[model samples]
Target: MFILLFSAVLAESLVEIVNSDPTSSWVAIDYPREVITLAKMRAMLGDETEVDGLETMEYVEPDGVPTSFDARQQWPGKLFAVRNQQSCGSCWAHATSEAVGDRFAIKGCSKGVLSVQDLVSCDKNDNGCNGGSGPRAMSYAQSRGITTETCLPYVSGNGRVPSCPSKCKNNSTITRYKTQNNPTFTVANVQQELMNNGPLYFRFTVYSDFMNYKSGVYQHKSGKQEGGHAVLLVGWGVENGVKYWLCQNSWGPSWGERGFFKILRGNNHCDSEKGFWAGSVKC
Candidate 1:
């Protein structure tokens, strides 16, 4: 009993065993929650970072936003509630849908939640739940258009990507949108876009240590490379002298900071200072 207890404690010190693989009996997390195994976790990252996103030359509404701001509290009624992506690597879908959904609200077009499952299942160019590209997902909305959450709710929570529905799952109203890249991807530009428009999309590198993140401004403390991930950056602020960018995760509200987390800002923290994109809801 003493030996077993010691082993358990040692394992936990390194990583949390959210779920165990039934057959392998491996201490690492299995499926449907958060993949703890390094390989599987890396596989979850589908963001194509090879493409050059480093560029800056555009307008900046300097007077539109304050130095420190949070869209959740400042804007209100323009954002959607936190959602759970389960074990599926559908972060791309969530980021794109949430950002575009916010545009709908900000534009006074619709207040309904956009269907992320629609993108996951239907966007054949990118893998369903396995992983996807944020920019591709945004362009999908632009060309093909997405539906309302009520129309085709998410059904990939079990880890496996579900088949695309022939039409809206239970409704008929399709919420379409079009996205354009933020050419001038700077901290100031990102903040101005968030305050003026809404959430924006970006692909950031995710390390294994991120799984254990509880709170505080997160930096790549310690852990092997997991892979690139996509998230909807909502706001930015300074906490206890730590400057951070606020982001809404698709890992459900039970995870980090009520489904949100603040990461280190400036100097392209987590590569968020690049590969940024945002769009509007096409009525």
Candidate 2:
């Protein structure tokens, strides 16, 4: 029953991304204006409907200046990285793998990497290689368990299910602390939480143009109506006098300036109010 629902959602999301036009051609707006409009839209939409478990926090005004310090500081010494969903609809796998990796790190383990391949191939309870719920995936890990990356290294391929490695070790170190679904989580609260916690998992409506967003503030382009569903959060940092949130992207190191981007913090686009942003295990 869950598998069927997951497949349906995955199919619908893929169609949205494939059919929507790119937003890169749209005119660039000042960072402050874009942030304000997005914040307003998020507020009007409300936080309850935006995500599953978003808790309200204090609000802060958007400052166009990027902060100088690295936002990754929020999770000190934690080796957090984003996994690109690529052409596959396996965002659930990505989110699960990242959370597992972080949990392993929290246990004071040096090589704290887990294989998405293990979950992709082993978990039959949910959709394989397609979108699945983060809580469901984590629950799957808790039940059957997972292995280290050295035991089952992930092949750099997407969309297709790769063959599982022969050796299977029953090693699972992930401990889920909190999970929330707030469709209306505000940006200020999200930023505050990320600053207080280690890392956050979020879902955004991605468009084709998002694939080409190299730098600078973004605004809606034609035909760009919520196309992508991803999991990422503020890493930490400051740039150009204004405080910026370090966005850990999964597109690989070559994709966007070493596989990351910076957005103005406290702004609507990166804040919790407009979208789903939830924190997880501390390292």
Candidate 2 Cα outliers beyond 4 Å, as residue runs: 1-77, 80-86, 141-145, 156-158, 162-189, 236-244, 263-283
lDDT over C-alpha atoms for residue 269 of model 2: 47
Each candidate's TM vs. the true structure?
0.79, 0.58
Off by over 4 Å in 1: 1-11, 14-44, 49-65, 171-184
Model 2: weakest 10-residue lDDT segment is: 40-49
lDDT of 1: 0.69
TM-score: model 2 vs. ground truth: 0.58
lDDT per residue, candidate 2, 212-282, as tens digits?
A: 34454333333344333445554545444544455566555654445666554444443333553343442
- State which candidate has the highest lDDT: 1
Candidate 1: lDDT of 259?
Answer: 75
Alpha-carbon lDDT, every model: 0.69, 0.47
